[model samples]
Target: MEKIRLGKTGMMVTRLGFGGIPIQRLTEAEAVKVVQRCLDLGVNYIDTANGYTTSEERIGKAVKGRRHDVYIATKTFPGDAEMVEKNLELSLKRLDTDYIDLYQFHSVNDMDTLNRILDPENGLYRIFEKAKKAGKIRHIGITSHQMDAAKAEVKTGKFETIMFPFNFITSEPAKELLPLCREHDMGFIVMKPLAGGMLDNATLCFKYLLQFPDVVSIPGIEKIQEIDEIAAIYEGPHNITSAERKEMKRMTDELGTRFCRRCEYCQPCAQGIPISLIMTFPSFVKRLPPDWYLKGGFIPEAMEKAAECTECGECEEKCPFNLPIREMIKESYSLYEQVKAANTK
Candidate 1:
């Protein structure tokens, strides 16, 4: 219902945009319905990615006749110029569009990766510049979970926007990165506004983020009900009431210790365990039905993968949040086993 300027791209996007990740799990027809519902509710910014299996295609199909009604943004993993070029073509094809409104280099976590993408000889930035000049994309943006990478990109003044995790629990971005974006006139897009679904109250989540006027949050939307819930917030009060703030404080305090934001920096576990997935199981157990967790790929085979962790501490070194990932994995595995046993009974 309300619009904000998307940095120097000069595109006015809705504060509550459509995040395309969850739509990948839905059937094409189902995904289309959800996306159309978003547009029907006047949500005009659609953020998807080349990495998200069929997200781009589904958004493309849903917005076929209504392309002009939305600003389409999508991303690809960082790579050399040639690889980026290839991915760009694939995204264009999948979206069935001539040009994307915003194109981002996805998940750049550190300065080294940022340098690689910005390198002139073989870097992806050059290709993105060319694409912009050729009208293949309207603007270039970058997304990352790491604050260091985000700060570095903002200093370079290369990207028109920066997408980062921003919620009550993860407030690091608000301190410096957000101020930098404001100073640079760069659009600040808030990803993971609900903290990877750890924060269940969508109304409070939206209220918390709306405090920062410049930031646009794209929470993952897969169901019309989610759209309805978010839309209700748009029509309601804009400011966070004192009571609401108190409730937020309580929720954050409760979740402060054990919650995993799923930044995925603690990746490539030595035992070949998916640390993010394993750590996320506990939250799923709390919020979702056991059958939903199992059918959603939290099967025994996957849960048992956590048992392979050697507790070597390598993942902890890389974890920015300093979570006790080792113990968390153990606890998550135990919960998974208990849930599985109970479900079988």
Candidate 2:
């Protein structure tokens, strides 16, 4: 039931917003039930993207009668003007709504892509502008994984909101993006607060974010218990206790600063390496179902491919966060060794 002003958008959304990704894993009826649970608990903001499989369609079915009760925000990948409009039309049809509360350009990672998308003549902004005029979308916003791109979007003063990854381990955005959002009065939509499911303690994550009441966070939901837990946080102690802080420190210390966010800006490696996936294989193995590992043999196959890095420095240069690609791949190799040893036992 707790709400905050969504910056210049002027829409007061619940601090605990609904993320649309996890619902894709559920059956259609189950997904709709999960969404209804959030809305029924007085949490009123939802975000979905075109790439999240059936997220948009499930959300559409969930809000069948009470569309006005919740504010729906969905995103589309960048495309030409016509293609962008097609995405919007399809989203509207999927959501079963004529207008969306917010429509964003999803994943504009670097300035080049940002500039191209914002280009007045050749980019998708004109299409968004036209759609805004036609009442297809009420406001325009953007989401990014890189700090540079996120900061640039805010500086342009064109977007109404900015979504970025911000958890205890990945607090780089707080250095500048947070201040810029305040200065520009742009809404801050938080994603990956749990570090893409790497952080197991959801209560700790939600409590940690309570210090920033001005921002809204959308942790992907696929269950009624998740919303109940968030509601309990709102009703319970509003600050991190000493025990909670110690637990948080332990989690962040274990995760460390070298986590790969899977941004994929460093793509198409000349050595035929999936650098992002290779770097994150350890985390994926931990978070997925137990049997997904399935003897963990092919993990070495992928890690060996990453081990072929020529140390050419090309991938590190393109990485927005300047991650040490070779070093992390080596770390992944070490982790794979441990997994391999365990499986052999």
Candidate 3:
């Protein structure tokens, strides 16, 4: 709805880019309708990832004859040169486009991962450079769930844009990342602006984020109602009552500490469990349907595995966000067990 210069890339992307993750759950026909509605409403920036299961294919289909009108940004989780090259080709093919406006390294979390990406011999820089030369990718970018890693990447002066989680609760770090990005003339695309839908009132959050001059917030929307609501914010003055801000603060305080960001730093369970992925199930249930999770989609395989946690405190020490990993996992397991039992009848 609101338009801003996307960092150093100099493209005027709408403040509400269509985040592509949520569309993965929708059928192709449904996704097409939602995307078309977004187009009719003037929200033109579309961001997708190669990992978001058939999302690119759907976009390719939805935007078939109209691809050139919209800005397409897609990401891949490629850690090496070969993989990066492979992914780029695959993304291009899937989207039915020759060049992507922005191609980013997805879900980068640490310094080592950053180094591996920029390394000339083994990293993606060479691949990105080659792509740019060949006119396959117009700009290079990186996406990180962790602000620290994103900040580190911005310092390298290599990226045209940087994508990181930017929301009301996690905005403090932007005080640091934003200036560096502005100084370098790099674009800043924000992910998770709604705190993964925990921030229930999207209007205030969108307005709050638009006040920052150089940042763009792309809250993924799967429904036409959300598309219309976001578009409406653009036509009017962005305002939030003092009382509403207080309410937002209170709600975030209640949920911020307990919710997992899926950073996956606290891992390598002795019993081979996907702790971060399992913890996210509750949010997924809330986002989509309670039935799927209750029917066993979200149940942690760690029944005995979760019961095995000895409160060693090792995971807490490793977590970037300092999530109460063991406690949250236990809670998820218990809640899911009850839901699973109820669904059996």
Q: TM-score of every model?
A: 0.85, 0.84, 0.86
| Candidate number achieving the greatest TM-score relative to the actual structure | 3
Candidate 2, residue 18: how far the Cα is off, in Å: 0.4
What is the TM-score (0 to 1) of candidate 1?
0.85
**Residue range 1-345, candidate 1, lDDT tens digits:** 899999988899999898998887677999999999999999999999987778899999999999999999999998666778999999999999999999999989878899988887878888899999999999999998777678889999999999998999887787899999989999999998888788888888888888898778898986899899998997798788899889998997888766776566787776889787787786556534455566444345568787888899999999877888889989988888888888888
Cα misplacement distance, residue 71 of candidate 3 (Å): 0.5
Runs of candidate 2 with Cα error greater than 4 angstroms are 261-274, 277-345
| 1 against 2, candidate with superior TM-score | 1
- Quantify all predictions' global Cα lDDT against the true fold: 0.87, 0.84, 0.78
How many pairs collide in each candidate, listed in order? Answer: 0, 0, 4
For candidate 3, list the clashing residue pairs, or say none. Answer: 7-187, 8-185, 8-186, 8-187
Give per-model CA RMSD.
4.1, 5.0, 3.6
For residues 239-306, what per-residue lDDT tens digits would candidate 3 score against the true structure? 77788789777866887777776666776666566677666756665555444344332244534356
Candidate ranking (TM-score, best to worst): 3, 1, 2
Q: State which candidate has the highest lDDT.
A: 1
Candidate 1 deviant stretches above 4 angstroms = 261-308, 312-322, 332-345
